[model samples]
Structure formats: C-alpha cells, structure tokens
Target chain A: MREDRHVVSVRDIPETLDDSALIGHSLSEPETFAALFDRHADEIHRYAARRLGPELAEDVTAEVFLVAFRGRARYDRSWPDARPWLYGIATRVVSQHRRAERRRTHALSRMSVDRPATFDDRSADRVTAEQLQPRLARALTRLSAAERDLLLLVAWADLTYEDAALALGVPVGTVRSRLHRLRAKVRRALGGNDPFAEEPQHG
Target chain B: MDDEIRQFAEGRPPAPAYRPEARARARELLLAEARGGGRFRLPRFGWQAVAAFGVTVALVGGVAAALSGRPQEHLAAAAGATQSAAVAEPPAGDLEPRPGQFILVESDTMYGSMTMGRNGEESRHLYRTHRKIWQSVDGSADGLLLIEGREPRPWPGQRELPKDAEGRQSSLWTTLAACPGAPHRSDYTYLSTLPTDPAALRERLYTAADEKDVDRDERAFGAAGDLVRETYLPKAQRDALFEAVKGIPGTQVAEGVEDSAGRKGVALGRTAGGTLTQLIFDPATHMFLGERQTVVDERAGQAPEGSVVALTAQLKVSVADRLPDEAATAEPGGGCPSSAVPPTEQPTPAATLSPPENVTEGPEPAVTGTMTATPAAPPAVKRSPSESAPAVPESGVAATETVPAPPVAPTETAPEPAAPGAGS
Candidate 1:
C-alpha cells in the first residue's frame, strides 16, 4: 500500500547512485530515470546517428530513454550495468527505421570516401577506415537485421558478447550463432577471410 | 568480429552534436505525461465540462499503454495506476433511461443459481422465464413474471416439466417493485432524472450501493451493470457510461468475447472477495446482451470451483408500450399474478431457498435421456471459473450425455468429486 501511495520524480534521486540502483529507486520516483538518461544518452545517440543518420537519431534517442524509463519495473536489477539494457532498447528503436538504415548503408557503399579510423584508445594501431568502409557497408546491407544489430552493438557500441546477449534478451550461444552467420556472409561477399586488412598509414 | 565490419560499425558518421532542443522537448513531454497531460477528444453531446474531465482522465491513464510496443509489462502498470485513480473518484457510468411512456423491456432470461434446501442439501438449478417490465421513464412500472412450473401438457411425454424448462406463461401481469433502497428509494422518477454526467452519477450511485460498506467497487460496478442492462440508453449516453465504468478501480475490459448466446461482444468485469462478475456488451452497438457471475475462491455460501453462480441470457430487450398481449391481465395480489404461474407445482417456500436459486420448479424432464458419462467431460471450449456457458448439456437433445441423467436443470458443472449426480 505504501508503494502505491507515491510515485517519485527525479529531484528526489541522488546523483551518486548506480544505474541499476537508480532504476530500482525510479520505481517509486519515476523521475529518477533522468539521472540514467544523463549518464547514457550521449553514447546511444551517437550509435543511432551512425546507423540512421542525424535526423532520425534524435527521435530514436528520445524513444529509447522513454521506453527504458517506462519499462524500468521489469528490468532485471541483479545486473549492475544499465548500459546493455539501454543499448537493447536503442537497438529496437533503431529497428523501426529500417528503411532509413538501409538507405544509409547503400548511400555509404556507393561513395569512395576517406577518413582516419582513430578510435581514441586504439590510436597506437594507427590505421584508417577509409579503404574498407565502402565494401564493409555493402556487406552489412546483405546481412540479416538480427545479425546487423548484434554486430553493430559489439563493433560500434563497444559492448561485449555477454552484454549483447543481455541487451537482446538472448543467450550468449544465440549471439555467437548470429555472429558466425554474419562473418560467414561477409567472407562470402568480400571473397576473403581477411578482406578488412588495416594497412598501416605510412605517413 | 571482422575488422572491416568492426570499423564499419565503429565508423562514426559526421553528424551534429546531441541537440539541447531535442533533449528539452523530450523532457517537456515526459513531464507533461507525469503530470497527467493530454486533452480528451470532447464528445459533441452531454455535459461538456464533466465529459472533458472524464476523457482527460481516461486518455492520460490509457494512452501510455497504447503507445508502448511491449504491452505485457506496461499494461499491468497502467491498469494499476488507473485503478488507484478510479478509487479516488466518485462512482460513475450510470445512464438515464429514455424519456416519456413506460419503456417496456421484455426479456427471456435463463438464470442458473445454487439452491440449498432445509434438508441440508445443495443443488444447482437453471430456470427460463419471460420477464416483462413496463416502466414510465421515471420508475413507476408493472412487471409480469411468467414462470411455467408444472402443468398438464397439451401433448404426450411433456407432462411435469422441469422448473427451468423453456415455456410460455399465461399468468396475470402484476405491479413491479424495486429492491429496497434501489436508486434513491427505488423510485423510477429518480432514475430517469439522474444527471448524465458520469462522474456525478457514479458518485451518487457509489454512495447508494456502498451501504453494506464492503466490496464498494464491485457493488458500484453491479449497480452500473443493472442500469445499463435493465434500462434503455442512447448511443452517446451509453458511450459515456462505459467510459465512466472504465474509471472504476477494478473494472477490467476484455475485448473480443462471446456471450452464452454465441453473440460476440466485449466483456467488462470486476471481482470482489471471491466472486467475479462480467457483463458482456456488443462492442459495435454497445448493447448489453447478458451477464455471468462466478464463485472464484472457496468461501462460505459459495459453490464449488468452476461453478457459474449466476447466469442471465437476456433473450430479448425491446421497448414496448405495454406488457405482451398474452401476459396482460393481473390477479388481485400486488405481487406476481397466480394465473401466470402453473397451478400444479407448488411454489417452493422462499425462506428455505438460497438467495440465488429461488426461481420456478416442478418434476418431469420435458426432454429426458438418462445418460451417465463422465459428468466433467470437458466442454468444447476451455473456461476459467469466471467464464461461463450452459452448466449441463440440455439433457437428451445431444449424444454427449450417454448415461441416463435426467435433463431437469439446464445448469452443468464440474461434478463434485464424491457426489455422482445427486439421485433426486
């Protein structure tokens, strides 16, 4: 009865709380999820933007947070990290704009673009994404939607296989099977196992 | 993962930064939602102010679940939220009957009830009766209750029919009376004069129905069901009434259900203590077809599980100027006309009967084939105790009842484990 009496808002929540803790507390104070949004929104927005372009990304980002907040009650709290769950939600939201996603991939594959792939922490490798992106984009368009979601979460969102499973609400084995199917298709399309060789930029 | 694919996924497209405007607009939407935002699509008729408020309350509570793609979890939360809000409001969803002359609602009702006799024995009985009530829009009316008990049949093998067998009555029409304290002193005038504003009507009805001080929402829902079924209402008023009932704490809406008569409709339900009552309505027309009540948990004065405690199939509900031609005359008694009831079968003393099973009766199975198969052989459809249908197969008409069980009562049930059909 006490639980039914009041629904809490964000102001009552402490900033120091962890995501799962924030989610649990948000049950009483639904606004407490604002803290969760502030913690994870940037990364999810970047992921959506990369997949569906900037315009749809904004809508997808907002949808992800709202959906996560609404379904917080069903979230499994035993897991300490909320990122995987948020990414799972973002994956579903991004899924709705499938036409827009395919358009982005097809558009990218047609271009002869050049850009340095200096992912901040992996800078010592000193490789570029320009040479491989076009072919990779074509390969991505050929893969299944479920495969694409899994590969992108790991490769783009930087989630581990286990986290991807948690996000997708599937077992790690299923994630591995999707991964295997994706890589096999890419190999067939690219005509080689190591088609994405990161040639050292000899500057 | 392939490096090219990794770079493809890790690849950043040059897009603008996360805009503060999007974030701000989203927050505004969220806050508005939290504060119960959104305007109701106002209806053209009825009390505008109350209707708007009612619609707003309904939308703010109902819209989120509609929007959520994963409804399994969110719908429950929304229902919980709506129930608490409903409890705070005054009772609602009452309708005012049509204006002018006595609106005669003539119905053929097949009611199944549990009967307990002074012999410390309990039996379930189902009876069919033609109930006609001629009421002026205000509440004053005459009712004719024609129950065929036991009589000399015009043909062979039709003698001494069961109490609940379908039969026409020729008894006199008698004055109808309301239950004690029904709608502001059971006055027809008060019922017709009720405000169409759902909230106000609900509030007023809730107070009257809550006299026992227990199962408030259930009682209020019952009262609402009564008004909606027993009286006639216009379309707009009827819609307002359902919307009002939707606001009650335990009102559950079950879409795509079929009533016992095989007519499809939406079922609105509420459960109190251990009894679940459902009033089915034709969704397209919003007409009340029938209602069923089930005894959910084991409690005193309740029958076994899966027993349909009460069922009423409204054979027909039409507006007529007077009682049907055959049931027109009234005897001297203020109650039911004696001539209207069959003369041979004695009226079972009302005091010995359970509140529900006090209808009509006699002795012979008009169509009896004594067949004894598994009494609990599952019916063609699956049913929760709350969902109902004919309790027992109407005896001999079908091959299903292979054993020699007489078709006295139409009610069938999951047989009590020990008692193989009580050898009456």
Candidate 2:
C-alpha cells in the first residue's frame, strides 16, 4: 500500500519541468501559471519596451501575460517551449500600438549621435552602429508592420527562422524570403554598404 | 544571425528593466484571477481601461461625469418609499425646469488619473475638481462647463505627489456646443421623454451603445447613476429610475455611505470585477445624493481593499434664468486652451454626438453620449400599484449579504446615516 501511494509532494514536482507540463498542471492548480510568467515576463517586457518605449511597454507586457493566461487552456501542449506562443501573442499586442511604434522609430531616426573616441573593437563596432541608427530607424519606419514584426522577431528577439515562422504563424519559407527581401532593403538604406561586410568571417 | 541584423540589435537603445512593483501588481492580478475559480473576468477598474475611457471621452467631447452608486441600507428605504400609493414627489421642490430656462448643476467630483514618468514609472492620484454646468432646458443652445481644479488626493501606495499633479488650481471655462443635430441627452427636454415605467426604462438602459469590455449590467447601472447624478428629473421620472435600478441583477444596498462632502445617504451599489459602484440617495427623501466607487477586492483593482477610487457629491441642481457673461461671449470652437481645462472637461467633438451608428444603438448615457436623443411623447406619470411595490424584500439579510459588505458597514445599524465612507 505504501509503494502504491501516488500522491506527489510539492517538493517532488521538479521546477525544471518544461512549459508544457507546467501549463498542463496549471489546469488543476492555477497558481502553477505564475511560474510560467516568471520565466517569460522579463524577455516579453524587453521586447515590448524596445518596440514602443518603456512607458507603453509596461502596459503591453501586462496585457500580454493576462491574455496569455486567459487563453492558456487553448495552448497546444505538443510544443515544449512557450516562447513562440508568447511572442505570437506579443506580436499581436504590439501591433495594437502601431502608431506608437512608428512614432518611436521616427523619433530615433531624427536624433543625431555624438561620436566618442573608441578604445577597442567592441567600442568601434558600437560607434559604427550608433552612426547607422538614423538610417536603420528610418528603414524600419518604411517597412510594413508585418515586415517590421518578422524582422524584429529575428533581429532583436533572436528567434531562429523556424521560431520566427511559428511566432508569426507563417510558413518557414515565408520567413526566409521576407528576411532576404528586408535585408536587401536595409542594405540599400545603408547606402549599399553592409556594416559587417569588412569583419573577419567566422565559421 | 545576419551581420546587418546583429548591428541592428546592438544599435538599439537599452530598455529599462521591468519595475518590481509593476511585476508584483501584475502577478497579484493573475493570482486573484486564478483564485476566482479559474474563470477570467475582465479586470475591474483597470488602469488601462480607466485611462482609455478618459481618452475616448476626451476625444469624443470634454470630460463626462464619472459613474457612481452605493449598496443595501438604501434598498430597504427605497422599498419602503415604493410601497405607498401616493405618487413620489421630488424631495426639495418641483425639479421640472420651465421651457427657456437653464438647468444649473454643481458638484464636487474626485476621479483617478494616471501619468507616466519619463523613466516609465506610473503614478496614480485622485484628481478633485469643482464643476458647475448650465445647459438650456431645451437642447437648442450651447451649454457651459466651469471646472476648477482642486488639490489632488494621494492614491493608496503613492509615495509623493507626482509633478503632473502640482499647481492644478487653475480653472477653465469650456463651451459645450449644441450642434445642429446633436442634442444634449441630459437636457430637460430630452430626459422628460424617457420611459417612466421602471421595467421599460430598465430595458432602455440596457440597450444603449455598449462600452467595450464593460459588463452590460454594470454599464446599465452606471447609466442609471449618470442620469440622476448631475441632472434634474421630474418626481415621476426620478422614482421610475430608482425603481428600475432594483431590476438590475447584483445590486446591493449599503445602509450608510457618505458622499465627498460628508453628506450621509443610503447607497445602492453593484459590484463587478471587484469594484463596487454606488449611487447614494438621501435616506429620508430618496433624492439622489451622489455616486461612489470603492475597490472591494484589492487584487482585481490593484488598490487597497475598500479604497474609494472615485467620488462625487451633487451639491445643487436648480433652474436658472440666464447664462453668464462668459457664455454670451464664448465662441463655438474657442474659449480656453485645452491645457487650462481640467482633463475631465475637454470639449467633445461633434462627430460623437450624432453619428448614425449612435442613433441606431439607443439613447446615449448622459455621460458617454454615445447615442442620439429621440423625441418621444412624455411617459405616463401614473405608476400602477405593481410598479410601485417593493421589488426586493425588506429583509436585512438580503441587503447585508448580496455583495461583499463594504468595509464601512457599522455593527449596530447606527441611526445616524453618518458612516464615514472609506478611502475618500
């Protein structure tokens, strides 16, 4: 009878369970959802802040998690990770503030960067990037909201092509083609010079 | 990652880390939702909803009056008043405004306002304003709104007054334009045409243009409060409005609730998403006194439980013979800079007034002004016996237990209606 007992103590449930298991358990124990929030809230907040400045990001981040929690029952448990689903929801949430995002990018484009003396490769790279920010922001403003979303999910959120496709609910091929076209447009915007073209290539 | 993409990421301005307080607040709301039997309820009194409502109202026209109500002690009194065969009369005097006269309404109102700092921190405070408005008895002429900003009250958990709240003593006068097709809903001419039967009025209240995300019952209850708070209604219409309020499911009465000015009254309140909006009435005369909104659950509203986030005291409503000199000189589009106008009293754009979509929706609530006023024959004043009968039993238990008992309810049903309303 002691060997047959099936009750698991709270301590016995490992914290390392993947998101799918946590979300599955949360159906019976709703507090289990908080662990998911703790795992993803920082990255979600950072992604939202990068798009719409910090002030509006606070609201967007909160809304994203609430919407995710409410719709958690419908989540596909086949996926082991929750990042794609969260980023997908985040894409929609951030889209609601399209005007704010445009305003932010346009504001950045008009700002002049003051150059500083560089001491190392990292600082030099940073200085070069700062110099290119004006054109980069302007190029971002010119992209359609969909293109901007896909570009940023890969470029900023660091999603792989497959994950970007998952986040945007598109076929992976579409991600590759869109990125190819967007890179060309951004390269053109940078006066046909790629900032990293001169760097030593690494495998 | 592509080299160009890598540079793009590196060039991005650094985002500030999420504030711990904000994170905790969001967590608390989530936990509360989980504890609430795992059903998702739209956040009650969410800062975003309130801020959005304010912005929507501002874009549509100037600041509309805040929504209000109180709970159970008043239900018993209201029921007692309804039993008698005698027609209910206005408490002070004849509230009917004669044709060509203006209806002057004065009130002290406090509502929550939120502002974000440059660093992305949000601060909330209760902005108090003294508002005086005069509208023509008929909706033919423009109205005037004179709002004077008062000292703002600190919201619960506020450390110090935000810079946005400082030196807010300036007053501004804005002209409430009565465009060719847009009639003011609260004007006596429009209100007099409302259904006098409680059930019909209640139905009409429900069918108004729905505010996105607000529960229908809560919207109707808030609409009823708006109709009575800053406008004068005839005795019969006022009586019908009060009676109709009982038909709204989830209404609870609070025996003794105080308005902002310290006047004691019985309050009829309905709780939704954790905030209880109460409409207070003079217990003796049943005259609508004011409105109060209290956070009954801290988790949903992100405030201390029992915190009164909004309050209004109706000081006076009387007939006036003429407009002030300022009104005479006020142009249709120009009077005061918008910054000078209290955030609540910005002039409404004409598009919100007479849109075809609004006309089809139904009569607009006096505050949100989402519908057009249709002229109907005055409703019959005679109340049938059944209509006058108490809708809810005068049982003490029903009143006490219907909703979360407001934190202010005294143990001994104190004879004096003076229960200090919480967190005002």
Candidate 3:
C-alpha cells in the first residue's frame, strides 16, 4: 500500500519538470498556481527588498511573478531548474525599476557614522558585509548593466555562470568575459589579495 | 577574467519585495484575459465560414469586372501620360515611367505571435525598421539599415554550405556578402549575391577600406560599381525583372505620388513570378525612392520566403543618428571610423526602432494621443500601474462619501441623545 501511494504521488508530478512547466501549470489553474506563489513569493520578495528596498520590492516582486505567469508559454522547457528562469524575469523586473534600485543602493552606501553593523548580536560575516558595502557599491556603479547582472546573479542568487547566461539570453562566453572584467575591478576596490586566481571547478 | 569576477563577487545580498496591490491588480487583469480569449487567437470556425462566404461574393464581383474588362481605359490613360515631365503631369492613373537614377528609402514592419498550448499565456513582439537603399538605372542595388529598439533577432533564410563548413556557420561571412555597400558602423546592408571568388572579394574589401578620399555618394557608387563587376548575379531573377520592364513602348516619365512613407513620389506596381512588386520614385528629381516586392503565402501563414524589399540610399540615412558608433561596430565587418571610435565601445543602435511620439499608418489613426500614454507601453519596462491608468474609482468614491456626512451630523446628534435615554 505504501509503495502504491508513493507511486501515485510521483505520478501526480509533471511529465516534464522544467521552469516553463512549473509556471505553465500554475497559469492554467489559479488555485494550483497559488501553491507556486506560496513556494516562491517569500524568497522573491526578500530578493526584491535587498535590491530595491522595502517600498519598491513589494511592487517588483509581485510584478515579476505576474509577468512570468503571463509569458509562461514562451518559456523554453529544456532546462529543468526554474530558478534561473525566475532570476531572469526578476532581473528585468528590477531593471524596469532601476531608479528605485539606484536610490536604495545609494541609501545603503551612505551609512551613518554611528550605525551598528549587526542584526541581533554581530557575527563576523555581518561585520565584513557592512565594511565591504560602501566600496563594493562604488565598484558596482562602475560596471556596465550586463556585467553587473552577470556578476551579481552569481553572487546573490547562487547561480552558475551558465545559468546566469540563460537568465540574460546571452552566450556563456559573454557571461564569462563580463564576470572576469567585473571580478578584477571588484577585487581592486576591496584591496584584497587576488582570491579569484584559483579556478572554480564545475561538473 | 570572467571566472575570477564571478568568484570574487559571490555571496552578495538578495533582491527586494513586491507591492501587494500591484500584484493583486496584475492577477486580476491576467484572470480577465484568461476568461476572455487571448488577443491574437485565430477566429472560430463559424467566423471563418462567414469570411469564406464573403470572399466568394467578392470573387464573383471581381470576375464580372474581369469579363467586362473596363479597367483598360485606366491603363491606357496612365500609359498616355507617361511621355513627359515637360508636359503637365496627368491626374490619378497616370503611369509615366522615368529612366532616372535616383536613390530611395523604404521600411517594413513585421510582427509574429504564437501560442503553443491552451491557457493563452502568450508573448508578442512588434518589429519595426527602415532600410536605406540605392538602385541604378539598370536595377543594380545596395541597401543599408539600422534595427530600431527592442527588435528581436531575425529568422534565418535559406543558406547553402560546403561539407567542411557545416559546423562552422559564420554570420560574418554571409552578412558581408549579402549587401553591396561597405559595412559602416551606423548601417548594415543586405546583398542578394556574393562574389563568385571569395579570395578576390576579400582582397578588394581590404583595398577599398583604404580609399577614404571618396565622398559618401562616390563611395556608394564605387561599391555598387564593384559589386556589379565582382559579385555573381544569379542570372534567373535579374533577367526576369529586366524582361518585364523591357518592352513597354515610348519612354514613361514616372510622376510623383505619396508612398507608404508619406513622401511624394511616382509609383508603379507589377506582378512577376508570384511576386507583388512596387517601385516609388520622386518625379521632380527622377530619384528612385523605394521598392517593395513581397511574395506572400497564405498557406504558410506568414511571409516565410521569396519576399524581398529594399528601401535606401547607398549608405544608411536616418531621421536622427542616436546610437553610438561603437554599438554599430560590434556587427561583423563593421567599417566604423576605427580611429575615432574606442575599441571597447560596441555599437548598439538601441534608439533606432523607438516609436515616434505621433505614429501614423497611412493616415488612419491607430492610436490617439491620450490612449498612447504609459498604459500602451509593455509592462516589462518602467511604468507604474497608476501612471498607466490615472483614473481610479477610489478617489471618486471618497468624494461622495465625504459630501453627505457633515450636514447629516447635526440632525443625527439630536437622535443620538434620545436613543441613549430610551435604551436606558
């Protein structure tokens, strides 16, 4: 009986598991789509808040999923993971509200002198993040939009460069080149030993 | 370098949140669209049947007219007036063809939309562009173009490849040979023929790059001259066009009329080998303005192939040049002024296809001024929901809710005093 139930549950899943399929199913059935909303809404909201701050994030995060729902038909389904697809949509959604994003970035950069670097009791990571925020902000401002998207998607969203390329509709070669240029500039800004000279291994 | 940047930039912050109301509105609109059929779906079977019946009636009427052969006078009238620019130009239906060498420009817009499965979750893109074209008296051609804003990539046409070159498909080689003109940063020209010998063509291209003393017009002429001398013409189609225009007796001075671009020019239309052909020319200057020859296939459902159109001077001529040169130079074989343009800058003509403030489709007003505000823009871009729809019911309801309260307050107070006493 248990084995039968397990098979039934697995059968209920989509024949093809992909970004387009995940979103496509939701669009077809609103109640079913609410499950997706429950799954991704919080994370998407958090991401928007970090990029554009609380006020704009609320609008953009909602808009991203809504637009994704509308355009689900055109989504290429060959890739199984929907995360990169979401990131791509989010990138455009964020780019649309760039003025708001810039304002948020600028506000974060201009930290008050007495501001504490921790949420709750300070951790070492928090302290480093705070210290790095200003200089990193300046360096980010210097990069082109394409370069910024490539570098930051990998950084914040935990996407591989190949995934980032799919999100940006660019060649993998372009993503790699842009990331390289971005890394050198960022490293110089951080005044760090060349940490990136060590290559990353990918399967 | 790319890997290093990606590695170095790892572990940054996340993005922000979305507004609840905006999200709600999007959900509402999407639901409504889903309830209504998708905007671009084909008509139902009943509608198609009605359309077929209507077409039958129209065809019968057309056949009657064909049997009567009443349009011969119109043709004769046009031919009679073809004799003279020195003579006063005739009224409508005058078909005076001029043998003048004039450059022309033409632009075409094509749109493709598809919905694969049910639920109507579709995406659509509108592509609009203009081409600069130059044609000699003998039908030699050159075309230059700049794709405007947000133009999707083009569909590939039929291509022949050698066995060794099967995997190594080079856009650079095909684009270079497609058009007659030099590939300037501001423009890319399309060619119907490639030079018979590739090595010879490359050598000439290299040598021509050094010939900077030539004026824009002369350079264009030289390119066209070289193309005729060097490029292999597929003898079949060129011969047909030549044969079609060859026999019509007496020189016809093409009168000028307004073309699709709103520019006044003389025009001629002909059908050859399943191609609908039209040529526009400026009567005053005897300059060729544009040519559109499209072979449309209703069966294929879109303009798949065998359709051709050219609009331009030898080089691209734009209403305004907004894109940076580097953006243009990114194109293969782009002859951007290398000395003036920095190497890092890639020429991208993002502004080329931007819609003008006021748009016209042959005097029929498609979109009015107020309707074209932020609401008409694609939701992917920078427009707020409120800005898109300025009028909301909330403010209107609030105004009515406020108006009745103050006057009713005093009368309600007297009743309120009695109500507390009675209850006690």
Most TM-score-accurate candidate:
2
Alpha-carbon deviation at B127 in model 2, angstroms: 1.2
Worst lDDT run of 10 residues, candidate 2 chain B, spans B46-55
Please rank every candidate by lDDT, starting with the best. Answer: 2, 1, 3
What lDDT tens digits, residue by residue, belong to model 3 across residues A143-185? 7777777776787666897899998989889887777677777
Q: Which lDDT value does model 1 have at A26?
A: 60
Model 3, chain B only, scores a TM-score of 0.23
Each candidate's DockQ score against the native complex? 0.08, 0.16, 0.09
TM-score of chain A of each: 0.81, 0.81, 0.76
- lDDT (Cα, tens digit) per residue for candidate 2, span A63-158: 777677767778889987889889999999999899899899988788676644232434665566656667679878767889899988887788
Docking class of 3: incorrect
lDDT of 3 by residue, B285-314 (tens): 323334434455422423445534222111
